[model samples]
Target: MTFKPLLAAALLATTAIAAPAFAGTKMKTEMSATPTSNIVETAVSVDALSTLVAAVQAADLAGALSADGPFTVFAPTNDAFGALPAGTVDTLLKPENKGTLSNILTSHVVAGSYDAASIIALAKANDGKAKLTTLSGAELKAYVKDGKVYVKDENGGKATVATADVQTSNGVVHVVTSVLLPK
Candidate 1:
């Protein structure tokens, strides 16, 4: 056999063998490049929410909130729960209260995402008033006063967005100091 021919044959065989390895490497790389939403869903610590986190998990809404769609959640801090009538949190936590808790929690969530600036603009356009439809089928009124966002539920319960614009890959979170009770 000519040396040149042998060398060409050897090169062809090496190329063929490397093709599958290269393909496998490409697949691994693609798999590792997960979306930012997935990363945020995992890294974001809803654990700090304590009661609110537990309620979301109990209502089976953890996955929904973790989904790809952007959402703006007005999360109530633990102190907000304490402000409720005594035994209210305990009652809502019971298995029998799942539906009620789910409704109340979902009522805090609007269908689409909204940042503080957008919300303020909407409120201003509406002459310091804006109505937002919640996942619970209730209408929540939003207003801006003294440069702070405040939301009122059907029952006339109000919550001030104590902290606004907590950005996540999937959505934003605004911490509220009160629980909005729906009529």
Candidate 2:
């Protein structure tokens, strides 16, 4: 089979074995030491972050994302992309839509390192909500309910943080099940 099919199978197997790997793992410094670049280098890295990875490379943001950012990225998984409306991913991947795709992906990222506590505090301070400005010039609103963090976009679409605090050398990553669309 082709690489994409093989990759999908591998990812499925890994997912079956791990079943939300970030959910139970504590944020250890050693685990955190896994460089974002290295993650991007690994065999299944691109598969796990298929859509966002493509967008990053297409947008020429790979170097910036691999740099010493201390950024906080809310990464959507392959399943999240699969859940998108039919043709959405294909359209985003087109050369003409590269800029738009990049903007949407980068909109999920914030400039500095923000841990869960910091995020929660920001939410509480804003009357249980916080508006975060992303590197892409878009805004994302964060709110905490029942101790779970939820992010909403300008278009009013929301995605819950399914797993949090997946730390990387360059930044922290929170896994969200759905894509957060920009207005």
Candidate 3:
């Protein structure tokens, strides 16, 4: 048995043994690399949006948001919710206040997907502010100030975009520094 032939055979055997494992890993990676989570699932996976997730569930808007939305959600973080007047979140979560909660939540969401760039461009074209009509028929103003994107509710409550363009299966989420309340 020549050394060269023995080495070649060993190399071939090693490649054959590794190929299946490599293929399996590659397939698994590809599967996981694609984002399959809808807006609700995406929100649930994000720790900072836990409060928002709870609010969505409470308002029974999770199913709607999880649908084939292509919605643009101005999602407020836990801190944003906490910064509200004490008892506000709790009150909104109550069964009797479901309508109010849904209104507020819907105000933060536009019907179509709008990434940061699109919002900014729209604002710029509209003379520094663009009105985004929500699912509730309420309008939220989007503007760029000092190179940062800001969303202002009809009542003048404003939130800075903390994180932008979190893509999901149904839509995209833009984390807001404060909850955008409806007028």
Candidate with the greatest TM-score versus the true structure: 3
Clashes of each: 0, 0, 0
Q: Could you tell me every candidate's TM-score relative to the true structure?
A: 0.74, 0.75, 0.80
Q: Against the hidden true structure, what lDDT does model 1 obtain?
A: 0.64
Q: Estimate every model's Cα lDDT from 0 to 1.
A: 0.64, 0.65, 0.73
RMSD of each: 18.3, 6.4, 15.6
Q: Between the candidate structures 1 and 2, which one is better when assessed by TM-score?
A: 2
| TM-score: the better of candidates 1 and 3 | 3
Write one digit per residue (lDDT tens) for candidate 1, span 47-81: 33567877776677777777776777777878888
| Worst ten in a row by lDDT for model 1 | 25-34
Model 3: per-residue lDDT, tens digit, 1-183?
011111222211211111121122111101110256677766665567789989998988888987898999988989999999999999999999999999999988898988766776787789889889999888999876665667899888999776666667887777788998887
What stretches of model 1 exceed 4 Å from their correct place? 1-48
Candidate 3 — which residues are off by over 4 angstroms? 1-34
Order the numbered candidates by lDDT, best leading.
3, 2, 1
**Best by the lDDT measure:** 3
